[model samples]
Target: MTAAEDVTVVPANEASWDDVAAVFGTTDYPGRCQCQRFKVAGWIWRDSTQEQRTAMLRAQTACGEPGAATSGLVAYVGGEPAGWVAVEPRIAYPKLRGTRVPWTGRSEDKDDDGVWAVTCFAVRKGFRGRGLTYPLARATIGFARERGARALEAYPMITQPGKEITWGELHVGARQVFADAGFEEVGHPTPRRVLMRIELSIVD
Candidate 1:
């Protein structure tokens, strides 16, 4: 296990595809989800082989390929990929269409490409509760903003006392992570989930 102090968060494009796979392949929580939940739609993902999913993730995130910029972010805990966060223009995720979390109580255009969304998170088993998500979320803001995202949104869950949610359930992320990154709650589409947003101005 890598020490927390040695952890570094880098763009997914900078790391090898294998490093990102290490995080997803560490366990078979659901057999190669590969953080492809939002990237693919419905049963099509179900039929895709692990290798297929892996290749899609690699292409989508552009891992280890400097020239390609359309991908997510990966967190390396002392040279080992320990976590991942999916941050991309809202339009990139077809599965989000008509989803209650992104639409309820909001009157925004569904096809806006300038609006980025933080769709999911993956923290490797041993790196689960070592304060990884927050940093990943923070780094995501910079990643999107630099790419000219006018606003970024995330659907994160609210945590409460006496309520213990498993990592699988909290894969979207925790509300506090967004709050700390200066995102304001735009709406609570679900009782446990909040749609948060942060506006960015290129002129600033």
Candidate 2:
């Protein structure tokens, strides 16, 4: 297990834009993604330029400006930004439209913004495998629960022992982290990805 003290997870709204940027780094991979995969879809996704995507991230994550909050939480290790987790109401992510997992085995009002969702996670180069995801996941619950979220959901990958999966595959996060955070598996649209959810009232 990684030392819990090594990192600090704060609501994105509370973190400075520069700090969040550091966690995401100045690289093309993260720069291009702009944490907007779920915010855009199909033709628009293909046509949208990086600049447009970046702006979308700025608007959604609420970076830089005071009172502006990212849709996720930023993680810092000993004061250095180390990671991020993108979470918000399901409606905030446009790409989720018509997604199979969220619709399978469950009937939910798709328009309900009270239902928050955990979509993505990013741990900086050296911060991986330090149990950062779990704390981030735990912190998300606190963040959402305090904000009056009725429920929170996550889509995570199921990794098997000795099976090496690429970082991209685990970007949504691992199942163990959600389980540790008290989210129960409610649906499985894909063998590798399971839909996990926890009602805020059940936390206690």
Candidate 3:
């Protein structure tokens, strides 16, 4: 078995589609989602078929093609797939543009593609509580900056002890998780959700 301390993250495109699929698994929210929640929006998202979401994720990841631009990152522990996180330009998430959770109190241009976002995460069942999200979140900073991102954002739940947030709801991440990665809570869009961000450009 791969030790948690050996976790190594790499761009999803650098990994094979099968490895990515292994992280996503075969049941529950992560399996059904394939991390496409933010890619499709509104009725389209509700109406889209599972097969469609899977195909979209496959193409989006561009797995097996090392040179293709990937939409997320994957983590491996001792050569075994362990986790996945979707990090890409904010503009790449179509559902986020029309959403209110990320912009409730902030005055910012919604069209900036240079602004990146961590939209989703999936940790393999056996690897839960191994602190995989920390490195995944930290990696987005350099990944986006290297790709010309001016800012990086995440919508994380404000988890409290004794609170039982469903795995599906917490898939975006938790407040403390991103905070540990150096993100600041800029907007409290809801009682349970917070909009956290890190500014690379210092413009907003």
Candidate 4:
């Protein structure tokens, strides 16, 4: 287990919107994105205001609503919301369907509901670089398996020394992050982006 595995991670529906907002802060990429990059389609996302995006995220997360279905997972450290990961059925992300990232070299069914994707991750501003994403990524394995996902996939940045990628571009994660979480690199869609996957059915 990674050092940050001790952090407690929970379903977004069980967390409060305030805590979720805290993780996204009020500035930086995560703040503006609200993790909706892959959720909404092109024109809808481009035309929607920040407030509309925020509302869409809140509804997707269903935060603070007990028994509601949530779209992601939230992490807490010392009882403070510290990180988040968007792991849901592949079909849930409308934008992902039309993107070249996942379709560049494979014949994957864009509508496969059994395949889940770890599309985004955000660590609280003050809580970043603390390995919070390690646990967040690991948690996705079980989160997806329990939800009946046959496999979990992520398109992550392959970090190289002296080569810097903006955090906004690395939201999916780094190559090692998913590797540590037991994902194997299956393809390199681009120089920085690599396709990683864990087969839940075989792992059992």
- RMSD to true structure for each model, in Å: 2.5, 1.8, 2.5, 1.8
Q: Candidate 2 lDDT, tens digit per residue, 46-142?
A: 4678788767766777765546545988988888888899988888887786678787877788899899999988888777788889889999998
What value does the lDDT take at residue 109 in candidate 4?
A: 92
Query: Which portions of model 1 show Cα errors greater than 4 Å?
Result: 1-5, 43-47, 202-204
Judged by TM-score relative to the true structure, which candidate is superior, 1 or 2?
Answer: 2
Quality of model 3 by C-alpha lDDT: 0.87
Ranking by lDDT: 4, 3, 2, 1
Provide backbone clash counts, one per model.
1, 2, 0, 0
Worst 10-residue lDDT window for candidate 4 reads 40-49
Clashing pairs in 2: 13-69, 61-70
TM for every model, in the order presented, reads 0.90, 0.92, 0.93, 0.94
Candidate maximizing TM-score: 4
User: Which pairs clash in the backbone of model 1?
Assistant: 61-71
- CA lDDT of each prediction against the hidden true structure: 0.82, 0.82, 0.87, 0.89
Q: What TM-score should be assigned to candidate 3?
A: 0.93
* Stretches of model 2 off by over 4 angstroms after superposition: 44-46, 64-66
Query: Which stretches of model 4 miss by more than 4 angstroms?
Result: 1-6, 43-46
- Which pairs of residues collide in candidate 4? none
